[model samples]
Target: MNDTTWTTPDLTGHRVLVPGGTGAVGEGVVRAFLEAGAEVIVPTRSEERSAEFRTMLGHAADEHLHLVVHDYTSFAGAQDLVEQIVHFRGGLDSVVAPIGGWWQGSTLAEITEQDWHSAFTVLGTTHMAVLRAALPYLTDAGAYTVIVGDSSAWPVPGSGLVSMEQAALLMMQRVAAAETGSSRRVFSLVLGPVTTRHAEGFVEAKDVGTVTVAISAGPVPSASIGLHDHGEVQTALSLLTAGEAR
Candidate 1:
């Protein structure tokens, strides 16, 4: 595990889409890409959310940031959302989904039906939908990344449901990577406790974004990466960036 923060990638001229760019973690990822010179397309659930994201970005939310009102929960919805982006901007070079929620304080036996429904329906199914819908547009050379929480590895007692959904998403990306061949890549950024207004922790949102941007830019050796595993991430990014330079 490394204590140092990951560096951002040079995404000059790249076109990227972040599904939930208004949220804390999502905002960091979006900012990193924007600073890296990528034109980012963000999809929000409503005009209000789009405006909120714009306010969040402040001065950086100009020209390069394109916000669309869309839902990503259903396969059909994700498909339509992607179609809209493609129609408007031609296509995307990368797509990153930070769309997930966490809840604790209940054992599996004590978990309610609504809890189970929300966990699987939103966290599990929505990720699958994103993957299915992005495939058509994310052909050769494109990258798809999903941000995963620490509960996937370090399962908590009251957060069993969170662990379950996170684990599922982790495997989802791994499977996508294995089946993808060399055309496109599927990756996961396994995160620890992040420092967000929504949650209290160690990892900073900007640091999280740096890692996300680094991986999304390319040359990752495997499908899933631990944010705390600095050696691996840095080595891969260094090698890849160096190769690009030469």
Candidate 2:
């Protein structure tokens, strides 16, 4: 996994959208795409947050970067938000939903209805809402999507809401592939822990287990920064960027 280089495809002014672009993995996606030369549009809940994210981006590449006031929690706000993003980019090419959920403290016996809903909102509702909002531009661009998900979502015991939601996302991914029929594409990168921020991102043991498999299956890039497996996350970004070209 060390000899081969997982080159991040050059975006060169390409318009790529990343939802939840201020969260843990979202920030990593933003930085990685920007480094690869895409005109990345990060949509979030507030303009203030947008500015803060811009500041987080560090250097200004005025010609190749932007932030949008896109809130996805509301069905009513979806259309207008996409309209605004489409207006900002002129055309859209890619989207990365590095958004998800995680909670380990509670066992099934201790889980509450609220816990279930909290996980659902992150893993299910958020994905549905954002995808619904962007489907227009996404279809227009030959729809490309990446679902960041937990490994435990696959038949793991006591997973509760997260598994159900991840399964739904997986079904959507497969159904989208069939429905797209070469017009568009989507994939679920059952994500693993990525070290960028202290908290990094939420990925289960199963996710990490898959990373070992991918590495064993082929060359793995050195993307982990500390205990955080940035390599896994960066590899996912590399795949999404490459999908645009294909």
Candidate 3:
């Protein structure tokens, strides 16, 4: 890993959608994309949440950030959101979905129906809904990236549902990549404990955003990349930056 940070790619005039941009990790992703000069649209169900996010972003939210107060948890709502974006922005160039949640509960065998529905079903469905709704409209050369946790590969005892749901999302990205072939790019970013604005960890949220923006800028060798720590994040960014230079 290098000691320096990767430079943000120039994404002026590009239109990108980030569905869960109100969350901590998503905030970094949103900021990085906006800094890269992309017209980033973030959807939220609450206007108050939108206001809060804008405040969090400060002046960065002024020009290119589009905060839409809309619910994108369901298929119909996701489709509508995409339609509205296309109609307004003329077209969408890319998408970065960092949508997820944590759930701590009993073992899988002892988990309740409500817990399963909330942790596994709802989170997984939201990702699928956004993918299905946005895939058709995504530019042929554009990218669709999914952000998941390392729990997908490593079992978390109390958060078994988070692990299961994250694994499912990883598989979904693989399938989508295979189905799309060379028409479009699909990437899965598997992260470990991330350092967000609220917590400390090996991988920082800004680094996550940087790698994600790099992926959107150009093609990568593989669809799945692991960002477990600072070293891994730097390696990925270096590889991506090198690819862009070519």
Candidate 4:
């Protein structure tokens, strides 16, 4: 990948909630929003994880990053979290759900019930919980972006469960966008192997963040976007930026 630096738009006064802000790809999303001057709120299940995320972002993020220790995996917990955030932040402007996990080791036919539940049910429910809780409260112009892997569109051997869940999320985003009409925006950001802090791949995590920030900001070209590699990322950014300018 080329050493290209892209600019993040100014997002002053915007309030954004990132449910999976502690993960590898989520880290990029959180930092992008924080750097863009948004009031970024991250929900973590434990205090230790919250502290680690804060440290990962460093001292500069303290003023804008609000790390809340809360379990948003359950429907009730997600509702409560949304209420708390809206009450405190005045209103929510955006949500970026980069929440999910990689599953392997068993073929679809060979997988146990527990494997299926762990790999699909838990993660899918969490995404749904957050969507149900926050969708109603989102501002009219607000955006809801779901980040999933390219597996959503393709099958992976021994990881069929992950693909199933990811595909479900993609459909969820589509349904949300259609149901909401033009009143609100919903986007599915499909990514390939993301190059994060711990791994190497085609697209950088920061680029993922940049694209997400662009989507959150406005003028997205479509309800579904794919960022499989550096070229796709740049194309997405250009499209978003162009739309914003027009």
Candidate 5:
């Protein structure tokens, strides 16, 4: 590697917890953290799938990068994940919560109770749980990030529920950021629609495969960004770990 200031991320010794970290983009974030010499913990409910994720990481799946099987659906589950991280390698330095689900195109009139609950669980509730769990560990030195979508920033024709949750999350993050201010850095990963298989429950099953690509590439006017896209993740890592160098 070149001796450039930006080549290596700033997370030299931080411990990062990535909720729903095994998915495509989330995995990319995990890998980026690992590359930055940070200890990466992936927590999810899937057991065998967690191991499979390790295998999928090729050769970088070492002791520093680990996976934990835990439910992220409630407050208690989030606490359990935090405890597991503490048991393994101390406390959390930062958290990357990316529980993206229930993201299909549905008009406000068509949204149902079930849909609302699902979106809340994936978008709002997950962030709530993770933040509550991380409260004890996060301080003036650490930060947390909630992965969000560009729809949160702008309007979409048939994404009322999504827009609602997205807007709520942005507000929550901003509030936390304001409260934390220079003490802690609460950030948001705002991106446009992504083209990947991670949209299993979010998209209309049949329309997902085809339309997702179209949405990513065509005149949807949405920008598709990834965790390992080289810009955002690196900067995030730097911000989270700058204390290490100091």
Candidate 6:
């Protein structure tokens, strides 16, 4: 987290779509792809949000980066996004969804109906929509990667609802991998406390960016990369991408 410098992967000719690419962590993913020489398309709910994202990118914003106004949370919205990507980028080589929000409330037993609805509908449903809509357009060696948190791997007392849905998304990754076969890859990156505009702690946004770039660039060694220990993500990725078994 201290070092601001990291190596980016080579992704020339790669076309990527990042839904919700305006958020703190999502921006990292977007920057990584652009720096890695990939054509990146990001979707935002409004033109204002897209403009804000462009501002954040500063010099990194170029013709390779596109900001589209579309909500990827609904089936129709995701379909529209896929259509846009196909028509614009000529189809996608990969999709990385750093899409999810952190919420805290009562314990599992005390969790209200609203809690369940909000967590599942937002985190679960949106991921399902994005993956379902993008699968057909993914290249033979393309990938669908989701950024997740530690709650999915370990119990987090009052964060039961978030943990449960995250775990479900982990399983969903496995299911997608199975259904898609070896033609496409589905994976998840589990991180420790990540610093973002929403929250701040151990991991920096650039660290997320570095790890994302390495993984998305190609031939991931594993389906799940756990950074809960807060290790040097890029180093691990180097080892993995060098053909080391996970």
Residues 1-246, candidate 1: write the lDDT tens digits. 243444455677677888877888998888878888788988888898888889878988877888888888898998888887777777767888888887876899998899888876677888888788886687344478899888888879988988999999899888887887666777788887777768866666766676667666766544566655445446545654553311
RMSD of each: 3.5, 7.1, 2.1, 2.1, 9.2, 2.4
- Highest TM-score, which number? 3
Error of 3 at 188 (Å): 0.5
Model 4 lDDT-worst window of ten: 1-10
What is candidate 6's TM-score against the reference?
0.90
How many backbone clashes can be found in candidate 4? 0
lDDT of 2 by residue, 154-212 (tens): 55566656667777877776676666555554545555555445454544332332232
Among residues 3 or more apart in sequence or in different chains, the pairs in candidate 5 whose N, CA or C atoms overlap within 3 Å are none
Worst 10 residues of 1 by lDDT: 237-246
By summed lDDT, the worst window of 10 consecutive residues in model 5 runs over 208-217
Better of 1 and 5 by TM-score: 1
Q: Write the per-residue lDDT of candidate 5 for residues 1-246, one digit (tens) a residue.
A: 111453443555677787867776576567666666677888766788887888888787877887877887688888887887777676677777666654775787887888878765466877888887885676343457677777776767776788788778878777776665555656665655444446432222212111211111122111222232334434433433342210
Instruction: Please report, in order, the local distance difference test score of every candidate based on alpha carbons.
Output: 0.76, 0.57, 0.87, 0.87, 0.61, 0.79
How do the residues 1-246 of candidate 4 rate in per-residue lDDT, one tens digit apiece? 353556678899889999998899999998888889999999998899888878888855758889999999999999999999999999998999999978986998899999988999999999999999998988864589999999998999999999999999999998988888877888889898888888888888878888888888876634788888878887887777777421
Ranking by TM-score: 3, 4, 6, 1, 5, 2
Error of 5 at 218 (Å): 36
Q: How many backbone clashes can be found in candidate 5?
A: 0
Better by TM-score, candidate 4 or 1: 4
lDDT, residue 24, candidate 5: 62
TM-score of each: 0.88, 0.71, 0.95, 0.94, 0.74, 0.90
Better of 1 and 4 by lDDT: 4
Q: Where does model 2 exceed 4 Å of error?
A: 1-6, 60-63, 105-110, 121-123, 139-143, 152-159, 200-246
